[model samples]
Target: MPSYAVTGSSRGLGLGFVQALAADPSNTVFALVRSISSAPKLQEFVAGHAHKNVHILQADNVDVASIKTAAKEVGRITGGTLDVLIANGALMHHERNKLMLDEFPDESVLDDDMLTFYKTNVLGTIHMINAFIPLLRAGSTKKCIIIGSAIGSHKLARRTEFTDNPGYAMSKAALNIAAVRYASKYRSEGVIFLTITPGFVRTLQGTPEEVEKFFSEAEAKIREKFPSYEGSITVEQSVRDQLALISSVTIDRSGDFVNRDGKNVEG
Candidate 1:
């Protein structure tokens, strides 16, 4: 069986990835969740599955020491080979702010929130990629997937059609840069690195206003294109599409920021 590790596996896109992978008979999923008890749905998922390939791992993306320990444990369990790795943990402080940038300048508490965002979204991604590169090298198909956002696309930002949480936008942009550099450095190692923007989806990271504004506009676009846009999409739909892209990715196509639908975003 092939082994895959996904961070932030307790909910949303991460949870969907774990479930989709588990449905495949040839895969073993090592799900890294922040708290085992806090995720009742995920725990129930593990319980409902009859397969012995599912493993729930406790991890903290903001803590290097915790990641090191989890990596060591997973290494021993998987015998030092991970077929696929997904850097899926991230945070957006602006989602919690009711004040706009003007009133929220101080509401953000920038020093603390920015540091947290960098630690979890930026540094954590780097740590996860570095820790598993050795194992990915041993797998049949080597891939490192980073889940990014369109707001982070420099080109998109320049187009005036994009908007997002300042912290998340900047952090994901940093993540893309890191992934590009890593892909270049590991070209000879055959470890393909790819970043994907999953498009707008209902997730746990945003406020009511932010969510309403984002999805309302996105839904409008979908309605414009498809006409039957009842706004229906399972989390699995997004995960499966991105995972398919990641699984088939190569150095020739790596380092390209594509959307969930597999179109290269202009960047």
Candidate 2:
């Protein structure tokens, strides 16, 4: 059986991954979230679908101990083997969507935001990989995937002149390099590490008005960059495309930062 563990599986793209992966009875799916009770949708899906292959485990990306504990639990269940580790948990400050770096009220505020972003987006991912690598090593297809952002690409930023969300973008850029470092170190072992962007996915997290406004603004910027770019896609389609890309990726393509279509995003 193909064993897959996804972090931040409470909702959004993470939940979509769990749902899709669990649809196949041959795949063992581990859904790691910060709190079991907090994920009502995930709980409902598991209870409603009764997917025997799905396992929900508590794991906060910011908490190293929790991740390690969850990894141990997965090891116990999967016999110390994990085929894929999807590092999808991240801190996305939607409220600060259009805010520029210099637009912050003060340096202290900027520092706090940057530090928080780094803690979750960069450090947390590193800790997660460190914790679950043992199980991954024992598995058949050793693939480590990081859900990255196009905003993190220097080339994209230059082309679009997208100067907002500096902290989040910087963290993702760092995450891409971190994935490459891991891929380089583990290349001889046939472990694959990749950072793939999910593209503009309509997660619909905020209020109706807020969601509308955010998408409108985001779409405008995206179109400005790529005139032929279509609107945002549903979580389902995004996850589907991402899964196909994941299945097709080989060790030779490891360490690449690419879009959902597996096209490289120039740094």
Q: Evaluated with lDDT, which candidate comes out highest?
A: 2
Candidate 1's C-alpha runs over 4 A off are: 93-108, 161-164, 205-214, 217-232
Give one digit per residue, the lDDT tens place, for model 2 in 1-267. 999999999999999999999999899999999899899999889888765888999998789999999999999999999999999988876566567998988999888888889999999999999999999999999999999998889888888887888999999999988999999999999999999999889886879899999899889878877989978989999999999999999999989999999989893
Give Cα-based local distance difference scores for all models: 0.78, 0.92
Which one is best on TM-score?
2
Instruction: Estimate the TM-score of every prediction.
Output: 0.86, 0.97
lDDT of 2: 0.92
What's the TM for model 2? 0.97
For model 1, what is the C-alpha lDDT against the true structure? Answer: 0.78
Name the weakest run of 10 consecutive residues (lDDT summed) in model 1: 95-104
* Superposition error at 49 for model 2 (Å): 1.5
How big is the positional error of residue 204 in model 2, measured in Å on the Cα after superposition? Answer: 3.0
